[model samples]
Target: MKDTNKHQGLRNQLAKQLEEKGITDKNVLEAIKRIPRHLFLDSGFEDFAYQDKAFPIAAGQTISQPFTVAFQTQLLQVKKDDKILEIGTGSGYQTAVLVALGAKVYSVERQNELFKITSALLPKMGIRPKHLSFGDGYKGLPNYAPFDSIIVTAGAPIIPKPLMAQLKIGGRLVIPLGEGEQIMTMLIRKNETQFEKHEFGEFRFVPLLEDKN
Candidate 1:
């Protein structure tokens, strides 16, 4: 699974397309360009990897579309070595982007199969997360609380209380909210009790399941 020149070309094109789609964060776009998405995908889907579309991965989850990953990452406003808690580790693609942006990523996944696969795969790609846990995303990583920012890759019905508690006073939590059609929601923690909520347009994601696999 070597990253070829052709793969790099496709990634470059995908980055440009993302920029045109209103993803203004240069670091996010560059990170998107740097990571080889096709490597994270199964061989059958490798040809379509750079097409900016979501495709099925193992464990009943889908690798997120490139634009959607960029959108979530851009909203997080990551800085160098920002401690980011990622709710899902599907395909490890989003984690790779965050790592490429110099983030200290702490990722969680519910599916045991996906978790096992990604935990091994990320290290092979040099995208090792600070901590990779198999547990509920809603619970977050309590021991490593006070994260600089948190990004939930699945559509949560409601923002989990534990996640809010784990964020630093000024941290941001990016998540998609709702059932059938989700609305991208960003929560900026203004204080211990006050959070500023901003809603982006609707996007669909698999439900964020709690305490179940």
Candidate 2:
């Protein structure tokens, strides 16, 4: 399936709905409009791609709802060329949005199935992140520390300390913290030992997985 005018129109409607729901970032809205969300899902679910709801994808994960993607991205306040570390590649929909906003993204996917599929799919769609690693999200990418921002796509029981340490001073970390139902939380590194925290209500997400082997 290809991205047609109909898909674009549906995306426009979705963006409008998100704006009404309080997504005020123009860049985030535009990225929502521009990226072909349909292309990120299975062919059978392509018709539901532009809706403001999440849909099931490979590896028992769901492609995040469009509004959730926009909301998290809006909180990050992504700037062009910002070095962003994404904790879950999932369907690569969020990765595409970050790329559309001109961030050099380094994403990690614990599910090897998703990592392989998305790593290949993204380049085909011309959305190339700086790095895509199939590993535990808990450890993060220490080699590429000091990111401008970090986004955790899955819900975490607790904020991973490694992700917090990977941010540059004043960098933001947007994560959904909890088990069952998560409270969207944002942390801004203030100094060597201080981080300002803010919560943005609740959201449902697949659990952040760790490599046990």
Candidate 3:
């Protein structure tokens, strides 16, 4: 819970690394720099927290690498107060980033441990997302349909049909699609029936499992 000047300097250095690697979104970079990543990780890994690598977290999930988080966020082009539905609340790191960008984040986590931990931790850090629900991420919070942006933090075999349907027209969905390895994919809803899709590159992530509660 203690964020010293050294920790802040490390975060700044990590932000610079992300910038050198082609992340040009200032807001996204700032969010990366602002969040105390070490606190989201187990205290044992605090020494390596700002190394730009994912570290294992509770519930068999790994905190996403900073570059990956920044890349997905840049694709989202988040606007302040825009509603965002985040799939996979593991470690609550990404959710904090979205909150820092001023999004009304609605996050879903299938693992109850992760959900409860993140639900409790976020508020302590003054990051109060619109809602944090414990349930299936694939379902995509239908009751709050039509999010301005949807980000899938896990690797899905295929895009969840419901999530596609849940996005507002012209809204964006950034997800990783595959099994052992994933292609970073982005979808922009064009109209009632069509979507424009593109693949950014490849990255590995924990699977977006089904029906785990």
Off by over 4 Å in 3: none
Alpha carbon lDDT of each predicted model: 0.94, 0.94, 0.95
What lDDT is reached at residue 70 by model 2?
Answer: 96
Summarize candidate 1's per-residue lDDT along 1-213 as a digit string, tens digits.
Answer: 799999999999999999999999999999998999999899999999999899999999999999999999999999998999999988899999999999999999999999999999988887877889988888999999889999999998899999999999999999999998999999999998999999999998988999944
Worst 10 residues of 2 by lDDT: 1-10
Stretches of candidate 1 off by over 4 Å are none
lDDT of 2 by residue, 77-165 (tens): 99999999999999999999999999999999999898999988988988888999999999999999889999999999999999999
For model 2, the local distance difference test gives 0.94
Give the distance in Å from residue 104's predicted Cα in candidate 2 to where it truly belongs.
0.5
Scored by Cα lDDT, where does model 3 land? 0.95
Q: Which pairs in model 1 have colliding backbones?
A: none
* True lDDT of residue 212, candidate 1: 47
92, model 3: CA deviation in Å? 0.4
Native-structure RMSD, model 2: 0.7
Best by lDDT: 3
